[model samples]
Target: MKRLKQIVNELKLTQAAPEAALMREFIFYSPKMPLRLHQEQLVAASKQFSLEVFDTYFAHSDVTINCFSWGNGKRKVLLAHGWASKALDFYELIIELLKIDDLEIIAFDAPGNGSSISEFSNLMLYAGSVKSIALNYAQPDVLIGHSLGGMANVIALQELEITPHLLISIAPLIRLKENFEQSLDSVNIGAKHQDLFFDNFAKEFPVSASHFNLTNLYQLSTAIDHFLAFDPADHISPYSFLKEFLDKYPAIKSKSFEDVGHYKILRSLEVIDDVVKRIYALPML
Candidate 1:
C-alpha cells in the first residue's frame, strides 16, 4: 500500500489528469480480502444458532446497501463491522450475544464492502447506510461497532434522533485528521498534495474534516450508556485515541486488553464475554 501510494504521489507531481485518476483510485478502492478458513468456520458456527437469517437491500440515494439479520427478539442489537471486512467478521461476538434472550441481532455489509455491489464508499456513505438501517428497519437498543464502523456510528449518532440504551465501540477510529495525515505520510505524499487531498476530500464528502470530531457530538444529556474496549497493543486504532475519549467522558465504562491487538480483539472469547456481561449488567430499559 505504501509503495502504491508513493507511486501515486510521484504521478501527481508529474501530471494533472493521471494524478487525479490515481487519487480517485486511492479514495475509492475497497480491499476484497475474503474471510479465512477459520473465519468461515466461525461464521458457519454462528449461523447454527440463528432463529432466522435473511438478506435485505436498502437503497440510499446513491448507494444500495446489502445486509443480513439473525434472531427475532424485540430488543434490537445492531452490529457494524470495519473496513475490508463483512458483517460475518462479528460472528463470534454475534454467537455470544445470541445466547441473550429478547435481543435481535442485525449485521450489514456496507456499500462497497462484503457482498454489497457498490465499488466504493467513504465515511459519510457508511454513516448514511447506518442511519438508513436504524430508521428503516429497527432502532437498535444496543449499538456495537468495530474500527471504521465505530467511527461511522459516532457520526450516525449525530443524525439519529433515537438514543440507544447502550453504545459499545471496539477499537474505534477517533481522530480523522490524524488518520488522514498518517495515510498521506505513509505514501510519502508531500505538503502540496496533502493540502490538495483534504481540499478534494472535502468536496467529495458531505461532512468536513472539522465536523467529523466525535467529541463535539457526544453529550451527557444524550442519556445513553457508553462502553469502550480497546486493546492497548492495537496499532490500527491506537489505545491513545480511546484514552482521549475516556478522559473526556468520565462516565464511559472501558476495559483495556493486553495482547488482543485490533482484529483478534473482535474474535477474542474474553472480549466477547466482557461485551455480553456489560450488556446484561445494564438495568432493563
Candidate 2:
C-alpha cells in the first residue's frame, strides 16, 4: 500500500476513479502505521496483563477477528480503537478499567488492523466488524471508542438495536466526506476524487454519504449517554466541523485537552480518569 501511494506521488499519476476502481480502492483500503511509536511496549504491556486473547469470525469481511479480554463476564465495557490502531493500543485504558470491580473489558482488532487482516476495508466494514464484536460476542453495556472506532461505536448502537448504557467518543471522525478529503490531503493526493467519491459512495451505501456522521446518531438510537473528548487542535479528526456540530447540539457532554493531540489523548491521565468516572456512573440497563 505504501509503495502504491509512493508510486502515485512520485509519478504524479493522474488521480481518477476510473471503471478500473483504483481510486475507490485507494480511498477505502489506505495503509496505516499505528504502532510505530510504541509497538513493542504496547504488545509487551498487554501480555503482562494476562489478557484472554482470542479470535472470532467476521463473516462479512471473511476474516477471523482478534479480540482481547481482561476480566470475566460482568458489566461489559467494549473498547474500540481508531484506524490503524490495534486492540492493545488500549492497554493503559484497560489497566484503568480493570480497577473497577466486576467489569468485563473487551477490545478487538478491526479488519486490516492488527491481527485481523483483510484486503478490503472501509467505514462500513469497520462498523460491521464492531457490530460483530459486540452483537456476535460481547454485548456491551457501555461502548467506548477512539477515533474511527468511536464513530463505529455509535454505528454499533444503531445496528445492535439497543440503547447502550453510555457511549464515549474520544476524538472521533465526524464527517466521512471530510475525513476522506483530509486523508487524501495528508497524502498530497489533492481533492481530485471528490466527485468520484460521491458517485462511488452511492453504490457502496444505500443512503447518502451525509448519513455516515454523528448528526444521525441521535435519531438512530435513544437514551444513549453520549460523551465526547477531543483536542481543539487535532489535525487528524476535523475540529472545525466538530465544534459546529457541538454548537448545533449542546446536550452531548464533552471536554477538550490542549496538552494532548489525537493519539496522545488516549494516554492522558486526565482523560483516563474522566472516562473511568463516566464508566462508574453508567445508567442501569
Looking at model 2, residue 216 earns an lDDT score of 51
* Over 4 Å off, model 2: 1-20, 30-61, 190-192, 206-208, 220-222, 283-285
Off by over 4 Å in 1: 1-18, 36-60, 220-222, 283-285
Q: State each candidate's clash count.
A: 0, 0
Tens digits of lDDT, candidate 1, 38-106? 766655544321111121222344566666666778888888888777888897888788888878788
lDDT of 2 by residue, 62-176 (tens): 5556676767747888888887677877877888897888788877777767776666456665677677766567788888899888888777677678867788899998887
lDDT of 1: 0.72
The numbered model that scores best in TM-score is 1
* Residue 254 miss distance in model 1 (angstroms): 1.4
Q: Model 2: which ten-residue window has the lowest total lDDT? A: 47-56
lDDT of 2: 0.71
The TM-score measured for candidate 2 stands at 0.82
TM-score of 1: 0.82
